[model samples]
Target: MLKKLSGLSGIAIIAILSLQTNAFAQNIVIPVETQHNALVLQTNKSNNLNIVYVGPTLTDKKEYEEVAAQYRQTDEYTGVSNAAYATTGSRSLFEPALTVTHADGNNSLDLQYVRHEAKKIDDNVSLLTVDLKDPIYNFEVRLFYKTYFKEDVTEQWSEIKHAEKGSVVLQKFASAGLYLKADNFWLRQYHGDWAKEMQPEESKLTHGIKTLDSKLGTRADLFQPPVFMVSLNKPATEDEGTVLYGSLEWSGNFRIDLELDNQDNLRVIAGINNHASPYTLQPGEVFTTPAFLSVLSFHGKGEASRKLQSWARNYKLLDGKGSRLTLLNNWEATYFDFNETKLKALLKDTKALGVDLFLLDDGWFANKYPRNNDGAGLGDWQENKAKLPNGIASLVSEAQANDVKFGIWVEPEMVNPKSELYEKHPDWVVKQPNRQEYYFRNQLVLDLSNPQVQEFVYNTVDNLFTKNPRLAYIKWDCNAVIYNAYSSHLKNQSHFYIQYVQGLYSVLQKLRKKYPTVPMMLCSGGGGRVDYAALQYFTEFWPSDNTDPLERIFMQWEYSYFYPAVSSSNHVTDWGKQPIKYRTDVAMMGKLGFDIVVSKLDAKDLQFCQEAIKTYNNIKPIIWQGNQYRLQDPAGNAVAAVLYLNEEKTSGVIFNYLVNNRYAAGSERPIRLKGLDPQKRYQLKELNLYPGTISSINSNKTYTGEFLMTVGYNPDVKAGRASVVLALNVIMENS
Candidate 1:
């Protein structure tokens, strides 16, 4: 097989120089080459199988470049338990290497392990099994990876054979093990920005992607389909004797930031997964294992994050005894430059409306008055004594005197180049040293990977919380997307990803430890970091800053799949200005809050706010703790619906929206309710408060099998006017 493949390609720079057979009729071959241009293998010569490397390499290394590792002495961090589940024990730890061998048998395939390195710290060497193996490869050759780990990640997790083509380079980032993927390189080529320069990548129209007016795409450009993945998994538990895989390769390089994404955290849990590799291990043949890990994890970044997830999972927010947050939002009152007197006036009027929370939004601390720009005032997490007179403390006192809780918004992840902190510690920001600094929203990301930065942030948050434990709520904001894939705290540009995420986690963790009881609100501008991972600690997720209700109606609907409605804090937006894009009702389904200044609320909007709050108060419990089912996809359909139930199974609420061009007239849509008693018949109540009413439909019926229930539908009105409201309750025996 080696001879046949070697003869076919005259530029066979690398071929297994030797073959060894041990216990079985197996053949093991280790090929040596400066760079891997292409990997082609004939498994059996008879066209039975062929292995090829057509993608990027380990370093994402470009051609004619040296992808070298400054190999450090193998040392363990500390104890055996510190080995995260991946490490077996210290005794077997050895040098970085690869093992390739084939178990010679009539029906045997080849197995390959590249760049295996394991060791123990403090005099212990742990034996490691490089987990890189693509047991089944009926699919095409493709390498897909994502940086998904939360804290701890290692190089072994994402090591795959590097790929190279001509002068351009491509690298594998399977740091996180295996994606549920089944696509081809040809498929990826058509849509990929990386491969367009060559061969039309995989052929399209005669004219390929023109770079004449070359412009790079946004972060989402990296997520095209046709991704190649090795479906890898592990034993269900520790005792299952699972081994981690290792791989190596060399290829193309480019600049990219993976960003502070938390979606993949749950996948890289350093434990067993249900989708382990599902094929036998053969020797000698090069097999690619793709994964994502904290491969570029920075260690010197002493900063760490604590989440309210497991620790405060059981905590429930308490209502204030004196009054609810009659909040005065600087955004609605005056977007950027509101002074103490302006806020004071707004507070006085809001107090009359029963607002208890006096929360300030952006533009309070910078000299620009309102956010004249992003970079100027953000790095300074201090009071703009100029506008905030007497600082936030005085306002806290003032609010306290008025019997209102004081809360402030802080976007800790950002640093404005024009702010004091940025000026003081210019090295603190992540840039290419001399390269053009990439700015997003006029901000630069701080290198939280450093302990000094961590302490600085800790001190800032601590001073505020400790000085005033009375701070009831905090809106933690992240206003910018990161760019310039470089980190001063890290050894190189590759390490930026792991370090930035570590920094975010560190700050959040410290905040949780200090203010365990405070209801921390998560707002990534809004909806950016709004996911289950953030919710594990954050009590509320501000859906977005754009409060156009027409937009919120569709937006909040899409937000429901992964998030509970009560945690989605959406305020009523201008129904008159942007009615098509503003939706007060769907937005109110979340933890209902106000965004506009109460002093500006007209008679009708104020009444609507009151009515919305009341409705929220009634259905709040069900939305908070109820089991949720996505009846309609707000993203796809004209509208969406949710069914909520109390634990007792005695009562439940069914809120449905006929959000569509109901003009095709009205048609009944079937909804199958879950978690109901089969034996009991429940009486239905339609909330008359809603504009439309369900004249009649399936009422009290025993749910025997998977019962089907149909809802009486109404025809279309305008775009967002149609709604269906009903409440289902299981009738009690005596009642």
Candidate 2:
């Protein structure tokens, strides 16, 4: 019923035509297209689908034939090895794409392709659905492939529907699977912990099973980063080799397995981790898995990342396109010692530093529950009248008068045992009945899976917005993990592990619908819930609580590969912990902000703050909306650098850092610039003009982009924890 499958031989065409009209042999082929590439798929007689081509666009039948022939030469299989929607018998040897248990007491499954349909949702979007039937169990699996027109990425997900005749148990189901031709491909993944998140690691794929999975019931950074990449041979640079990448779109427990066979066939599967507990589905009940997105790039790791970033900019992030407000948060300045007078003084200092926003973090709410620190007052959202007698109205008005917006922090997903809310509804916390509950930071996670609890959370937060009409922002914080995990509402305890994340999404969706314009930031004790799923609801993410610049250089580098700079809430903080200028330089690579005791700054430090803000504002456009290039990798390196180029490639900013290495002579490596017009002449200016900061460059001068990128520019040596910020602007176009 859709446009003809495009390309096939005489026998293949006859086979396809015969199946299209017959109910028993109906098959479909789906073609997904991006701006520069096309992914063509074909369904065989058994309804099994194969990835025909993931590289260049197939315009004609001849090109498609050649691609298919080339594919068959490598991966010689009737099916795709692990086809979509279709299921293979146990004797097939490879992992079953969809394993199901029948009501007849047998767990083996063999699915036959039935019917399919195609829908063109938009000019840049298309949807393909293929139906496969498990003849023995009378069940169906609907495979979906959603492709974006602008991004070279396709999202794959599926739904399992059963008939009313029998009950079935789904043993294992993959959201997406692909078999690729392998030749010494290098597999890359990210691993880390709380303050240290997204540590990139790689290894060569051998002839065996290699898997990266998380069974902690939470998508913690310590387990995995929810994304993986595979490149050819050695580590691919920003602009050279072929790279294939994939990312899971769920925030809960997930798994990604890369299984390579003896024939050099690499089969990759990614979806929600089953945790060895199979889901039982009754007649007419359906189960759906989270979406898994795949992308192929021929230009290298840098270009592959840029494609993902393009997708994030168009679909994931909020509608804002300008530079984020430079905020000065009052956490380190005055934690828990909340008073009207001290906050007012800090507000005055914030205004003097040209900060665009003021965030009154923590200790602003829960007076009746006595929330002073991590020990109390989490779930209670009532304002603390004792702390601020006049309420937040005065503070909001003061910030407005100073040309700043006001925001507050709230941890709605957690509750302190000492709070009134927790006392009123003791069963609201997540815990197994009659068992001792575990507490982290003196708090327990709220059982969001309960419908009544979801409503209570929505209304309480909705009421806060209804009262405070001028509240511009909210810092949504999740301080602890879900321990003693059990929900009383569900009879099956295992469902709590999945439904909890879904319930959280429901609450966030309702809030986003109610307050669409107000931007909210996502933070999980800092860097715990940094994934694509959470990014869909929040504008920015707090990657870590650690403000150490040396450590953040590595964290920020890992975060930038899949996310834009504007989505990172980086800050300048704690000069005593690190050099003030160096911290400012590190924060400038992201959505720049400040977190410090402003009143403690001397005249010289105050001047440095003002100068730093001025310079950042001048180059904020490129830093916010630009292509990033990692000049030097930050793998225990003494020197690391990152550069940002505007869309037109005319102007950019470069941040070069000198890590904890004092031996400056050997560390002076020439830095090569990227993502610039080679024919354009550019003027470079050094931006480290603070009191204690000094530049390594010999001079501030002009050079062609070609000379800068190829010939390279050297940094001045002699440093003990230092940094350099350079602003480049196009001076002349090529004649």
lDDT of each: 0.43, 0.76
Deviation of model 2 at 24, angstroms: 11
Q: Write the per-residue lDDT of candidate 1 for residues 1-735, one digit (tens) a residue.
A: 555565333333232221121113222221111121211121222111212222223344233122112213234332111111111112212111122122222221222222233334222112233322222211112222211122112222322232222111112122222111112111102132221211112211121111111111111112121111111132211112111211121111111111111111111121111111112322222233322222110111111001111111222222211112324456765777578888877666556555457677777775543344454888676677767768777777877778777888877667887787777888887666778877877887777777777777777767778777777778877655556655666554543444454455577677777676676677765554533334545777666666755456555544442245556676654533543113445554656566666667666656555555555567667666555544554445655555666657667666665455555523244555655666665765544243232344445543331342333222222234355455677766786
Native RMSD of candidate 2 (Å): 5.3
Instruction: Estimate, for each residue in 1-735, the C-alpha lDDT of model 2 and write its tens digit.
Output: 224544334544554455444534433445666776776666655545666656667666346545555544445454546454435554356665577777766766655566667788888778877776554445678888888777787898988887634777777777887767646678889887777778788888888888787765544455477888888655676788878888888877777878787667677888777664477788888888888887788888888877787777777777436447788998988888878777777788789888888888888888777678888998888878888887788888777777778887888888998899888998888877888878877988888888888888787768767876777878888777777777777777757767777888899899989887677787877777777777888888898887788888988988887788888999888833667878888998888889988778888888988988988888887887788888877675667878889889888888888765654532466788887788888887788567865555544477888999998776552365367788778886453
lDDT of 1 at 261: 12
Q: RMSDs, each prediction? A: 16.0, 5.3
Task: Please report how far candidate 1 places residue 160 from its true position, in Å.
Answer: 14
**Which lDDT value does model 2 have at 451?**
85
Runs of candidate 1 exceeding 4 Å displacement: 1-328, 348-356, 367-375, 531-533, 575-582, 635-639, 661-675, 686-721
